[model samples]
Structure formats: structure tokens, C-alpha cells
Target chain A: MGALHEGHLSLIRMAAAENHRVVVSVYVNPTQFGVHEDLDSYPKTWETDCGMLKDLDKELAEDGNNLGGIAAVFAPTTDTMYPSGRPDQAVNAKGSFVTITPVGEVLEGASRPTFFRGVATVCMKLFNIVMPEKVYFGQKDVQQTVVIKKMVKDFCMNTEVVVGDTQRAPDGLALSSRNVYLGTRRRKVATVLSKILRVAEMSYLREHRLRDELLGPAEQLTKLLLMEQHQLPPEERVNFEIDYISLADPETMQELDEVDETRGAIISGAVKMLPVEVPQPGEDLGLSDGPPVRLIDNIILKPVKL
Target chain B: MGALHEGHLSLIRMAAAENHRVVVSVYVNPTQFGVHEDLDSYPKTWETDCGMLKDLDKELAEDGNNLGGIAAVFAPTTDTMYPSGRPDQAVNAKGSFVTITPVGEVLEGASRPTFFRGVATVCMKLFNIVMPEKVYFGQKDVQQTVVIKKMVKDFCMNTEVVVGDTQRAPDGLALSSRNVYLGTRRRKVATVLSKILRVAEMSYLREHRLRDELLGPAEQLTKLLLMEQHQLPPEERVNFEIDYISLADPETMQELDEVDETRGAIISGAVKMLPVEVPQPGEDLGLSDGPPVRLIDNIILKPVKL
Candidate 1:
């Protein structure tokens, strides 16, 4: 999926630094999207994406590095990705699919049941097609990184998975293609996702190791945000729905009641931003109508000797 | 899986001929077996298996072929194949699994629902680990060959899949490790699987293209075999249970009501052999007492101009 944002660019840049030739696969795998998810509305900035890649290559050339900059951009069509015809987004939809469970069945997968199934299946296909020695993924989708790693390990795929730190806005909103769907007000509110994760991270860093202690403030802040929105004038209010605030084992993605002192843990969450009412005739405040803009972010807690 | 029967040898020899080195995986994949299926009883002639490979290498050396004999035998432990712990054999068992549907769902799949899922999953792991230029499968497992090919194509796997002709005993019985469990009487009747497939193949070659017309004689022969077995004395009888007699498209594994003359089809079936009585103290006939020994075989019809 390519809107060529700063986040995607970071992964590409990282890949270029490591490998001599990097193949970028720009595919909005339909199999990965849920029936109601943003397959149609998902950004497709092809011309801009290509231009950005070219610009990145020029920038790398200027850097005087021996590393190759983007050898080929594999922009395959839906037809190429799913030659057996596009897979049905429904959970039970049949065809060729790769599924990783336990890890895939929690959090994001629990919310969007078939989401990781689609992700794993597409990633496997891409891995086979590109056959890259190393693959890069943004930590923005933390659980996705875990799922892919597990799939690669479990399937014995001869590819290394590299994780790039999440790129964020000045407000700490995780950079995402879906971010474009956020209206002005919703955009401001979406940062709450990353905010809560940070709060949990700060708590964990302060040695508040108990699961409840770590997640308590984050949950409280989410509730307070909802309450504050409820008190606002209905038309001006933005509804915030917190999907999950998870402190999980990074390897298995299994919810951890308490983070292992040595292994640490990943604190992550998803929040949906929805405008209470469509922007009035006088005010077009950049509010979307169909589905809420779901924002997700995560923080990795390093192990502490304490 | 390493009983090292002629069928397995054929695949190994074919692979050796095509590639510089051949890695033989001899793990009895537990994931592929159903819970009640013979996971425990399934033969584990590892020492004999290695001996056979060595013997094959000697023969290859004697042949003066430039092709390398067995270079390595990758006999991974169960823990190695399923690092996240062994996957449960139950249908709904969750883990990382690769599934090819439609093709994987019909024919043999319908009989053993999760059979192809395990096959596809394990094959993916093996392909990734070995990264072979070409892989080989014996045509004795016709449906399995189809499933693996579809998985490779669907996943865009790099390796080419080559099908070795089914190796058979003098009686036209497809050679299989499971044959050893058939005992003497059951072994004789097990040949019925291949015989019926040959009947269907002969019918197709003679231009008897109609579905029922082609299957009629073959099915009648099976029924006649069962009737004959029924007429035998209780101690002498061997049970013949036909799981299925399928005339299916070679590509999709979908049952074909009528053979597609141009595209051709596969004639296949599975027959279970069960001894009616336990071996008495005096009677030392080689008859098994546990679950029926299932034997499968198939014949491919070449597409005809007429």
C-alpha cells in the first residue's frame, strides 16, 4: 500500500542503506482489507509515489553512498496479486490463504478478524515474488510485525524482517496513509492514540510494572476524552472510540497481564475518530461520513535492570 | 514420511536428476495426520530410510551419471518443524498454516479436510528452508501433486514442481509405506484402488467420455470386489470400503461429471482395507486389527484430439 508518506520512505531509506538493490512492492492487497474497511478509499498516489521514489533516489545519489537506491518498484495489479480472482474479504472466504494464529487472533485481529490473515497471506505472496533477503516494516503496525516475523519463522522463509521506527507528526499522530481521511478536528483528536501509549510507556519507564498500573492512566485518559466530547455541543463534538489498549508480549502478541521484567513488552492501542454530526452548511470542518478513521500506535518498552 | 518406498525413491531420483543436489526431508509431519489417523502407527523406518538413500546413491554412482546423488538428508525433529509447538491435528487447530482452497477442498481434501492445508503449509516451510530450484512429487499422490502445484503458483514460489510417474509393484499396486501395514490378505485387495483407476483410464482412452459411463465399469468392479469379500468366510474376509472414486479435473481437483477431452482429467480413488477377524492362535495370516488401512491411487488421462 503506497501513499509514499514519510513512514514508507523511512523503510525504503533503511532498506537502501542495508541492501545493494531494493525492490519496493506497492500493492494494496485486497485480500487484507475487511468488507467494510477502506479498500476503495485507501490512498493511491501512483504518480506522486513514483515521483517520491525518484526524488529519494536522487537524494541518495547526492549523499555519496555506495548503496543502490530502489532498483525496481514492483507495482502489481490486483490481478497479479490474486490470480485466482480477488479473495472475498469475509472471514470465511476461501482460496489460497496463509494464516498465523494466537498472535493473529488478538488485538487488531480480534477487532478485524480476518485482517492479519489477509496481511500474512499477502506478505507470503510478496516474499515469494520479490524473494528479498530482508524485508522492512514500520513498527506502527506492531502486531503486524510480530505476525510477519512468526510467519517467516514458522514457514522457514529465508528472509530477514527489519522493523523501522514509526514516523509521527509533531503532535505524535502516527504517520499513516489512512491519516489523510482524518478531518481537521478528527486529526487533532487522533493523536490521543499515541498519547495514551506514551503515557503507558512513561508509566512503565517509571517502574510501574503491574499491568493495571501501566494501563490505568491510559484507560482513564480515554474515558475522560469521551466524557469531554459528550459534554460538548453535539454538532461540534468528535466521538472517540478506543478499540484496545494492550500490554502484550512482543513475540507472541498474547496479552500479558504483567510485562516480563527481562523481555519487556509492547504497549499499543487503536482509537476511532468520528464526527458527531456532518459539518453544517456554514462550517465544513473536514469531517468524514461513512466510517470512522481508525488510528493505531504502539510503544516498545526496553527491559530495565530494576 | 521416510518409509523410503519406491514411490518416495522415484521422487528423490527425479529430483536428483534435475538438480545438482537433493535434500531429502524425512520428518513424519504430525500436522498432516488426523487425530484418529495413524500418526503413531505410521511407519518410522528412519535407519532403513537412510540405508535406502545410501543404496540409491551407490546405484546412481554406478550409473556414471554426472548428476550428484543425495547430498544431504534434512531430517528435522518435530520441534524444529513446529517451533511454536506442534500444531494440533484437529481441523480447527490454530497455528501458522498455509491453505489452498477450492483445489485443496475437493477430491482427497473432501475426505481428509485438513490434509492439503498441512501439505501446503509444510511444503512452504520446506521450500523456504531448502530453496530448491526444482521440487519433485510422485504422481501416485495425484491430488497432492495438484495441491502443491497450486500452492506454488498461488504463492508465486520460485521452485518448479516436477511430477514423477507413480512407481508400482508388479501387481499394479501403487507402492506406499502404508502398504506394509496392509498385511498379506489386505495387501492383495489394496490393489483394487489402482485397478479401478486403470479401469477408468482404459474407459477414457477408448472414448467412453461420459462420467457415469466411464465410472460404471470401474465402480462395478469395486462393488464386485466387495461382494466377493462378503462371500468369504468370516476369518478369511477382508473389508473393502471405498471412500471415493473421483473423476476430477487435474488442475482444480473439482469432480468432473464428464471428462474434458481436450483438458483431460484424473481418475482416482481411496479404498480402506480391514480384516474381519483377528489372527487366531493357529491362523497366523498377516491381518491387521486396528483402523482400516487406506490406500489411494490415480491414473491421468492424456488429452485427446477426438
Candidate 2:
């Protein structure tokens, strides 16, 4: 969880501005990853992460404003987090677990069944450990923000959940530690996730509230990308697979047929990128074998006075 | 949960004596009750419950010692507890829930599968809502205390869990709101639950550490009760059904084949009572119809310096 990208920094900065003290919890949280997903491959830049936090603190201090800097960093071992035993990655794994239903079982959760359970469980543990007055999350993971909010509301936890705006690259790719996994070509193509969400956002801004109207162009663009890749020579093709494109109620994460004018909605999606041919020896092509690199992004539609 | 018997009062008194403020929550959490269980029939003497708390506060105030009294009573409705629709009574019901495993799946949990899930979930909600420094539970519910302790440790909750000794009647029957359901004849027989637990406790103190040695007499007593009821005339018999008698590790709630003298153990059991015949018109015989009135009790074996 601690690659220390701009997205993570944004939340930290927001927390620093508001609270007298800020504690950052940097945990990979194994329970959230599916067995087949990239737990081992997930980035762990502890030294660089600390350096980044230090730099951010110095910058805040240099600004000559009274604001809280990093008070401490909570980097717990696996044993400390789970004293009983590590939770099984299986959906029905037997152990102490916190689960949010219906809200957690769609989109990302639907794709990776045990993910939200792991996220909710770990977050609950962290909240208890830190006992913070406020917790911050990046809107990059939209459904996760919704799930955590629901957990806090339903469980009556005292901490407030603050969502920071998603930080993005100049090319429009959402900032993520997993972004390092993208090879050169795949990196270029990765922006399509944000591109499609923007497409959906543009349609929403145009007052196209119907599900089909909002998602049509985005779906068509994904199909076109696949079509273009298939037309290329097999060895030259860069494959794309869209997992889901959701227009959903922000509170419940329920897929919506039409956006509510009063509450607005969130348009989110996930896509996988793969190279068709295995890389030759000494090849510099950015290609990965086995599981494809999955990227997700979302956009929030503010309620409009219609 | 608001019958306010001696068992509940002991916990309240303990809390008042220890902390500067004590908050008693009185909600018969629906999620904890199975559809066939006593959700509707469970006692709800709110006025009387408040009266008892008031009486206890007055007594605490008269002691002239510096101690806390009842600061507030949190009595949330089902809708307040479950903002999303109330969780289905089914085990696999779809909704937000907290689950503790292995520990929650044995002894009482094995008999009532969904019981601990409801308990863990509701306690989590209450803990978050109250955020008390310490929470009190009666040891009459041995498995519940163990499960809650595990949840607090595993979740890293801040509240210290305090267990009050099980308050009992002069005849050794554990005080419970459900005792009202026992008829005069069945009420006398109800003492068998504590009697069996005491039997196991006595054997443990005698260094009968093996499972069979410790539980043999207790189980035999239950068997004898059932046997004696069978020998009685059909209409005259007050039936006794032994659900389970467990000698378990107090920490994990795992059934132990042999008690570890250093760690000690807990001996607990549940028994169901039924009146074998319908009550005649104008009869005031203390008997109930429909589902059996189940009673549970337990005793702790102190760790021996072996």
C-alpha cells in the first residue's frame, strides 16, 4: 500500500491540513488480494516512501503555515495485524472477518470476490489501532471509499472518512503503484481506462443520464480498441479486456439504469492489458506473461439543479 | 437484552464501580436471533430495566465512595441498528456482518450456528457507538465472553473486556430473564445445568484432567435426568434434552481432550426443557408450549500450579 505516489500524498496532505497529528499506515493487506492477484509483485518502497513523506513534511513546514506534519508511521508486521493466523484468500475462508454485503459484491468485488472483505477487515483493524479523528482515502478507488463509508456509518465508528480527488499523469493515467507494472506500449494504452471514463463523464455532463447513453461511446471505444488489435499481426497485437463499466449510485454501489438528478453517480471501470506474443530474449518490449495488468479509474458526477 | 436480572445487574455494578461513566445498551438485536428462536418472546421490560438502573445508581451513590453511576442508556431500534434493511435471520443472509471463526464455530456456536456471528456483529456496532473504555459481560455466557475477547484482540479494539462472575440463585440455577418460562417443576430441574458444570469443576479440582474423567459424571447426570423423565408417566414428565457438555480451552473455545493445568479450562453445557403434555383448562402448572426453553451455564477451572 506504500508506493508513496501523488495520489497517496494528496490524502496525506489533506489530513495534515485538518488534524493536529497524522499517522500513515502502510500495509499491503494480504487478505484483500486474490490468490492469483499480484500480492508478491505489489510494490513496497519503504525507504522511498519514508523519504517522500519526509519531503512532504518539509514542504509543508517551508510553506510557513501552521499545519500538522507526519507524527508517526504505522508499519505493522503480518503477525501484528493478524495474531490468530493469516486469513485464507478463499472467499469463504474461515477466520475472524468483517464483511459488507450487496455494496461489496459488485464491480471490483464482483471481479475479485474476496477483495472488499479483506479491505474492510484490515481498515477496521487499522481504525481501532490508530483511533484517528479522521481517515483519508483517494477517490481513485471509488467503490472502496463507498464501502468504507458504509462500514463507518453502519458500525458507528467515530472517525470521518475524507475522500481526496484522484491525482493523474499528464497523459491522463490515474496515479497508482501498480502503474509500474505497465510496459512501454501497455503504459501508452493504459490511459484508455481514464479515457473511457472521461468519455462517460462528458456524456453525463451533456445531460445524458440514461445508462445506455452514458456508457455507449465508452463501450464502443473498447470494442474498437479490440477490433484494431485483432486486425494487427498476432505478434504485434496488444490485447485489451474490459472487466466492467459501471454507472452506479455512489452510496450503495448499486448499478443504476439512470442517474439520479439529486444524488448524481459514479462511473467506474477496470481493464486488463496483455501482449499477444512472448518477449524474445533481450527484447526491450514492455510485456508481461501470466496474468495481465489490471487498471481501474472512476469519475464522480456532481448533482445538478435540473 | 433488557430483562435486567441479577446477571445483567452484576455487570452494570462492576462497570459503575470501575469507570467514571457506565452506559447500558438495551437492544434485543434481531440479527442475533434465528427465525425460530425467541426474538419476539425475549423480554422487553424497558420501564422496569430503567427502574433497576435507577435503583442501582441510588445504591452506588449512597456508598459515599467515589464511583461512576449510569450515565446513559442506549436503546436503539432495529432500524437504527440496521440502516440497510434488517439482516435476514438466515445464516447466509446478505448484509453487513462481522464473523469470528473456529472460536465462534464450536460449543454453543456449533449448536446455534448463527449465534456468534450475530453477537460479534452487534458487539462491534455497540463498541463503535459507545466507544467505552471498558465493556462488561457476564461469564454465564462463557463462549460469548471468549468470542468477544478474541474479536477485541483480533480487531485491536481499545475497550478492555471485563467479565463478571455468573450470578446464581440459592439453588445454583444461573439467573436469567428466560427463567420465567420455566414452570415450577421444570424450574427445579433447571438447576441441573449448573449442577453438571459444578460436577465437572469438582472433577477438575480433583486433578481429573482427562476429558472422559472430567466429563463422565456430568454427562452421566444429564443422561440420568433424561432416563428418569422417560420412566415417568407420559403427561407427568418434564422432558430434559442435553444439547452439549463441553470441556474447552478458555482462550480459543476449542474442545480439549485434556485440560492443561497451567492454562486451565472452562466447563459449560446447554439443556432444553419441555412439558410433555398440554396444560388443562384453568391449570396454573408452570409449563410452556411450542419450542423448548433452553438454559445454559458454565464454570471456570482455575489454572493449577503443576
lDDT by residue (A1-306, candidate 1, tens digit) is 888899999998898888899898898888888898888888888999999999998887677663768899999887878877887999889788999998999999998998999999889889899889999999999999999999988988889999999999998989988877776667777788888888899899898888999999888888887888788887677888888899999898888888888998999988887754646555545424425788889999987666
> TM-score of model 2 relative to the true fold?
0.96
Residue A32 accuracy (lDDT) in model 2: 99
lDDT of 2 by residue, A10-105 (tens): 888888888879899999999999988889877789999999999998877776563788899999998999988897898879888999988999
Q: Encode model 1's per-residue lDDT on B130-246: one tens digit a residue.
A: 888898888888888998998888888898999999898999998888777766667767788887878888888788998998899998998888898889887777888898998
Docking class of 1: high
lDDT of each: 0.85, 0.87
DockQ of 2: 0.82
Model 1 lDDT on a 0 to 1 scale: 0.85
Please give, for every candidate in the order listed, the TM-score of chain B alone compared with the true chain B. 0.95, 0.95
TM-score of each: 0.96, 0.96
Per-prediction DockQ comes to: 0.86, 0.82
Error of model 2, residue B38, in angstroms: 1.3
Q: Give the distance in Å from residue A176's predicted Cα in candidate 2 to where it truly belongs.
A: 1.0
Docking quality class, candidate 2: high
